[model samples]
Target: MSSTLSRVRAAYARVEAVGRPEIWIDLRPREETEAEARAIDERVAAGERLPLAGRLFAAKGNIDVRGLPTTAGCPAYAYEPAADAPVVARLRAAGALVLGTTNLDQFATGLVGTRSPYGAVRNAIDPSRISGGSSSGSAVAVALGIVDFALGTDTAGSGRIPAAFNGIVGLKPTRGLVPTAGVVPACASIDCVTVFARTLAEAEQALSHAAAGPEHALPPLPRRRPGPWRVAVPPIGQLGELDEGWVAAYEAAVARLTAAGASVRTLDLTPFTEAAAMLYEGAFVAERYTAVGPFVDKLISSGGEGLDPTVAGIITRARDIPAHRLFADQERLADLRARALAELSDADALLLPTAPGHPTLAEVAADPLGANARLGRFTNSTNLFDLAAVAVPAGEVNGLPFGVMLIGPAFTDERLAAIARSLEPRVRLAVLGAHLTGQPLNSQLLAQGAVLDGTTTTAPAYRFHALRTDPPKPGLVHVGGGGAAIETEVWTLPAEGLGRLLASLPRPMTLGTVELADGTTAAGFLCEPDALTDAEDITRYGGWRAFLAGAEDSAPSGVRGTARSAPTHPHAPLGDHPTDE
Candidate 1:
């Protein structure tokens, strides 16, 4: 068996060995999972490039994965979708295999995992603690190493809190970036599909595939360059009810950020906290009522109540809220969004604890609503303001995990990923040809959210050629000897972004590790040996730009193909995805 298939088999074996029924509402059969692994190996052997090849993944019960019933954590409300949710389909297309459908809080109404009838998902590290939810099962699966990453829905703190509790990475992208087509909505308009993984790169790898739908219209945000960034923190007086352990952990995290050159400053958090209150205490609760209200009403009428009392109570109350009150709440939310954005104006991101505390299952059982509300103190405001956020493990407090989230403006998903990676580990890559700055295809780099680190030359081991194509691309072929240093640009892109870029490249080009002049190795663009046939040797020109300049100044010489007509960019903001453009 191939190494990837072997690794997958071991992972599945470990998951089976755990016997944690609460962690999954419905799991794909072990035989089926292994069969898919074998298929992936076959495809890889056949030379197909799958970005997430052999990676195991799970989906929240709310997200439709073909052959599984989507219950949204309420079994009575289950429905079998004909196909996977758009997000899940994207992950599968990129080579990830689904292991199962995980449990969640019923109707995605509660933050504590105990609200589910399937049973509270136990904390991965400490079984006595509440596994944060409604994406509880998804987070736990990732935390337990059963899956590389999982999909969750985030409205309120459904996505972030679970990651915080599980000591994993939670990436809730900007609202509307990932299409919600096949997801059971919590608050349809505000719900965002989220990613949970053991590392930022894993979450980002899934996000890069899932974020942009075929019809996304927003322009790609500029890459966030690494440096001493402005990070906003809430004033000490505003921190509520956090135990000493959590407070110490939070403070130490800030110190680390400061030591790492971040300009950590205190900002008034009143607006943010107030906005969070609007999610439950204000009229915005009506949106939740609208999402599953009919089904809820049917269950009640049929005398088949599957929802937890707390969840049912929360959604039922929305019926009493007047329409004008919801409108008034929306207007109030607009004002709060402005105020919150103002506080973040001078900062690249707002840094806040993902949750004030991690409650035990018994504690949650005693006071579900109160404990859940406390968890949202730092998270509920994000979606209301249409911002992006990444929750990462800060450190453990008294054996329990604590996490912090970095919030940025809408479309700043890539930027948040950058900041998240800076706090963890990352990969660096090299690029030439179309991705160079000011080139026709340079937007692809920005689309992938890569930052230019610096320019350097290869270690005198490659020959450059101008490929005979409509766009007049360049190709670098590594030669054993008699090669010259080739000019190239190095970028620190997320590993997932690099995968997407690799998958999108046309035939005759590939991504391979290249040696830089500084004696360092990085993933860089390369060409198939056969591509050099009938191609113009541009090694003497030094780089793509120089060759292009020479071509522009002089007549088309032998093998120097003329450039084709440039296409108009109507959706320059939407990025280079052929499906969208």
Candidate 2:
């Protein structure tokens, strides 16, 4: 077997060993797989190469892939298209083999993966929990290593929530970045084709292959210069219904960015939240109806034989919306979009929780609409206001994964990706501090591209100290000569890349050579002694984690109340997803 096939077969073996068969609706037939392998073999013989040569991928059933039936999770609505969606065609042209269509929430109306006739897509980490939807299968497929990457569609939180739940990267490109010419639409004007992958590099690789090109010509995307990116976080008052665990996760995520030398600040999200509400509660429901009205009507007329009840209910709600109401919603949305644009006019990107909280399958089924609405709390407004987003898995909270999303204005997709690439944490750093997993600032390291280099402790002589600042920062200043051995871990970053990163540091913090207990020197963060005069020293608490533990103990119950609850009608201020002639 070729190396790619060997790898794929190995991955498949693991999948079979796990006995998680529902992760895919179907797989490419053996003949098709062998044919693709042979084609790659021939290319190698001919000395021709492609970016995605021999890579395997799956598409959400809502996106047409020629011979696969486009089900949108409703067999009654299935259609066999003669051609692939533009995005799918591009990937295949780049030498990616389409594995087959995967499952989704029926009609892409729900966020919980179980709202389909097909079996629920279980979380890769914990099957009892949800694999978020309607991109559920897509995320699960990648998380389980079934495919290198997969194609999904994001209408509200379909693309992002699933990625967050499954601990993968979901890149929801700017609206129109990947044409939606052949995908089954949920909200046509707001629909976005998304990619799910195990790593940021893999996700970007998929994006680069699928991004915009003309029907007849492919022009390179415009390149831009990089600098210290200004990232905006929603003011604490705007964070709705987040638990202590998620709050810690977000704080840690921010510290990572700050440590990476990026400027992080808070901004009001009233305008953005208002715009998000209109997506479902406002007239956008009409757009969903418009896209599949005939199919839905026929399905209903035929006694709802193949339609998922939840989807049928959601689409049927559209029948009552009046044209005048839609116009009013449009006017409202225009004003909200303007305000949101004004708020974000200066920042390079905005960051927020991928979802306020993750709900279980039972919670979703018991109150499908409310549960799904909550998942889209921060996501619905993106396309309505014309923005691109990348959801990066930050870390876990109480064994559940927590994610943070970075968003940018439309067409700034590439820049946003670059920024995310820089912020992802490294593994080497996590091992050095006894911080390990679930520690404060650990997520920050991960955000910066730190992968775990396995665990180890400090050498025979070293001391650790926690410097007090408003948010509290960590310092490892060596006391020299007779200092005791400290327990710590090590993380690695590309040398040239680390230098470029260190050069961007701001005041009060500096990168310096530090002596480990083992008498080895490594680059680590240090605070100028003068800067610590007013800072509280918590070295007795050991590393950042111990300090954070105490902070959590003293944290007030009302601190979480500080975040604004997502308004019931998030899109109320913004009107709806815009429809064009």
Candidate 3:
């Protein structure tokens, strides 16, 4: 209970600190939100196992929240919703409280976040840059840590672009998969509700809850085909005019994926890009006019009081797309979709840059339409072809954030998510003792799904000792000058697994950063000064494995005492030590 309240209080504090009021269209009263968090705490105290217990989240303004006006980023379009949108309701039922409604592009029309009459949602990382939109507010809120996650609507990369620009995870489920019953649609048939979170796990967690309840629009969850991972990427020539930084970041991501055991394949991405272009350029855009044209018409009739000129121009003009053009475009889309999906047929997913570039606010101001269209170059095709995607932060391109998307067939959300998880940042742990490969404690790492990274020796700045404990262990302590280069093994695993291991590790030891002889540093085990009082200094042996070999040769066969103990972390992988065995 206290945890929930503390988090809520901290969230409110963050909101106040962010200094960006345009990120929200309506921020709920702090006290009211706290009260709700407290109530959730009480429910948990009663032995409930709510998945989203005590979680605080935000909803995009286009998503209806009871008592909050749905502005869709234009104040004149605002109206109080009588009830929560199904997605919001589902999250609330799972014990999450909606912190507020966030800002977006007007009528969810623009991809540059500047279309809102309220104000543009600035990039959380660099205020000078534009935050990708129309899911602007939701992405910024999550990026700033003001909320655990936020709900957004995506038709043409609104969900992904902001997330990429903000350096967060954006998970957009298959089109119409999560019910859109209460959302103010930009293109009703193609609009998808999405989740923005700091990590893939958290984003997926929110999605698990949001995808439940009444009026879901999809087939049952898909059973992924069993095989080695084969991910498709665009051919080098197809990359066009990307900057060196973007190209490098993307190649680095592929390298990381390869290291994580995925085979990479190249596929021509023209069909996908063409279909993406059609979402806004073809007669398909007429769907947006059908959604809010009448309201725009009424507003224009009333002296054009509150329309954003760019958004108005897009939607109003969409109304005049000839009827035959609409059918022709549909036929065109069908052929394109077939070609695109066919290329993806033999692969697990198609990986691509989340956006062509991250534009600064000034750059966007100079060419709003062109900049936004460019942002959608890698994104706009998903909904047009009923695909599922998960956008992940790959690395930085120069100083700005760069992201990549893993797109797969519709209903393959979970599969794409699993592949994306492999590409997420990982932790490399160095161990000088017990947890090494072939040791009794090595099973801990294996159990946690950790894989052996490699072996390396520490920098000559540590003293190694064999501790006197039930499970004889070796400890390495940084000694600055008199230390020797100690050998260690490195293992890599998910950050979550490392956390679980850290929590279960026993005392007198720690998982601290260790400098390797190769000039790299990694999380490694170290012991406290006091714990080494009566321990044997084995630095001369260079490593625990060497010491163990010497002891076996010198001691009698029966002298080896068996006193095995648990590994440092519950879920960990480690290296050799001076064990009696």
TM-scores across all candidates? Answer: 0.74, 0.73, 0.78
Q: What would the per-residue lDDT of candidate 1 be over residues 70-156, giving only the tens digit for each residue?
A: 999898999989999988998888777898999999988888888888998999999999989889999999898787789998999
Best-to-worst TM-score order? 3, 1, 2
Local distance difference test, each candidate: 0.80, 0.72, 0.82
TM-score, prediction 1: 0.74
How far off is residue 447 in model 3, in Å?
18
Task: Look at candidate 2 and tell me the lDDT of residue 94.
Answer: 77
Model 1 global lDDT (CA atoms, 0 to 1): 0.80
lDDT of model 3, residue 182: 92
Error of 1 at 10 (Å): 1.9
Inter-residue clash pairs, candidate 3: 435-574, 435-575, 436-574, 436-575, 436-576, 445-572, 501-569
Clashes of each: 1, 41, 7
Q: For model 2, how does the per-residue alpha-carbon lDDT over 209-290 read when each residue is reduced to its tens digit? A: 7883654232354453466778898877698888668998988888877777788877889988887788889887888888
Between candidates 1 and 2, the one scoring higher on lDDT is 1
